[model samples]
Target: MSSEPTHQNIHTFDQATALQPAGPHHWKGQPGRLYWNMVGPFGGTTAATLLHAVLLHPERIGEPAALTVNYAAPLADLPFVLEARPLRTNRSSQHWLLLMTQVDTEGQTITVASGTAVTALRRGTWAGSELPHPPVTPAENLSPRPPTAGLAWSERYDLRLLDGDLPTAWDGAHADDSLTRLWIQDLPPRPIDFLSLAAMSDMFYPRIWRRRALRTPAGTVSMTVYFHADQAALAAAGSGPLLGEARGQEYRHGFFDQRAQLWSADGTIMTTTHQLVYFRD
Candidate 1:
């Protein structure tokens, strides 16, 4: 055997999952890699960490059925506390409220973001769906997107754009084709879990960026997701480069609504998500 040592790259998803418990209701967060956005940590990762805080809570019950996160303020790249409190709990479901806060030199805690999640004990029953996964080119046939020059967070995912380009280069061939499809996976490929899946669900860039090729100031003000898959379904996907689609339905009054869906490689609808974004002309 050759005398060479081997190194394994860890997915950034796991790096963010390494939150340390600080107390009964709080955990510490650490920023990693190109996880930062134009102002702070990527919203997806921030949401994932918040959900993670709930998962680590001893009082948590069942799996996540729905989650809503509000980007109240920008997050600094310092140690922050994730406070997850169960709003209520019953035999079948539980609701939790989450907050991300930072302590200042004066020993005061500051709230940066807030979220709520619902976890429920799913039961076996007849399932039916009228929604179908959108047809797209198989991910294996498409090459990975070239990394965007300045966006560090973009490098964390292997995204294959099937429908639209960045607002920078709009061919204008299909102005009405606002639908954006991407085959995305962790940079190094990690198993699909609630945490990773939650982050992937928010991986779509702003819908306005694809609809109107303008460099307008836009951000997701609030996001919500409803999960349809359970732990077994997630495990069946293994380490997947999930197929995702997003599009804008309406835009007015400095805000727009976008809908997104994440499907497993086998065409299972894993999650359905929607977000309200704030935009300025």
Candidate 2:
């Protein structure tokens, strides 16, 4: 038999975001070109990698409840160090601090990204969702979104746009609002998990691209994802497409904020994300 890796069915997302243990609280990883963006690896993969480090921690408790990632600088395509530490662990919750750093060409190690995460032992309680799922055509009825030509990261997910696509004109005319609704899932159909959910949270394209119709430079500075569903809920979601909705709240002074929510076909809100983005004028 030919000598190939045993796990041939491993999905590309998992391989791209994989990390290896280096020390008690450190891991080593390198960026993969499959998720490369205009500048560096996709921010979603970065966030997922950071969270995955915590999940792989031996002392980890419960499931992810919240995660906030701040991109400090454009990550270079190089081997990097990941440090994850549990700051506090109580009876019901745990807090963590994470940092990713890489050595620059000048031989100085600098931070590229940092984040804070919370995992908790979920307890049953009375709950209700005030924001009902948006009414839209089912995923089966819509055609798959055409692949974005140059961005490799966009190809990782199968997207079916329902509304609010990129502007047809580039004349700097601003739309009245920035809103996009789409169905999204891993292209090769990986099982739904916290790590995958974390990545999917940052899947939307910059809202400014659709709002102003201008191809201005834009990047996420900070992003936060709040998990509304526990492990069982996520498992139930399987590998099916999730309905994702994103809209911009405000844009001012070269910065804008976006809010997005992802829901299961059955109407369970899996996660909600908010992010602050930097853009060029």
TM-score of each: 0.91, 0.96
Cα lDDT, model 2, residue 175: 86
The C-alpha lDDT values of all candidates are 0.82, 0.89
Give candidate 2 misplaced runs (Cα > 4 Å). 1-7
Clash count, candidate 2: 0
Among residues 3 or more apart in sequence or in different chains, the pairs in candidate 2 whose N, CA or C atoms overlap within 3 Å are: none
lDDT of 1 by residue, 1-281 (tens): 11222234555666755699898888997766457778777888888888898888999899999999998877777788788999999999999999888865677788878889999999999988766777789888998888777677777778988887576665433366468888988876777888877888888887776777766788889989898989999998887878898888999999998899899988898889999999997
Q: What are the per-residue Cα lDDT tens digits for candidate 2 across 19-49?
A: 9999999999997787889999899999999
Q: Model 2 misses residue 86 by how many Å?
A: 0.1
TM-score of 2: 0.96
* Residue pairs with clashing backbones, model 1: none
Candidate 2, 94: how far from true, in Å?
Answer: 0.4
lDDT, model 2, position 85: 95
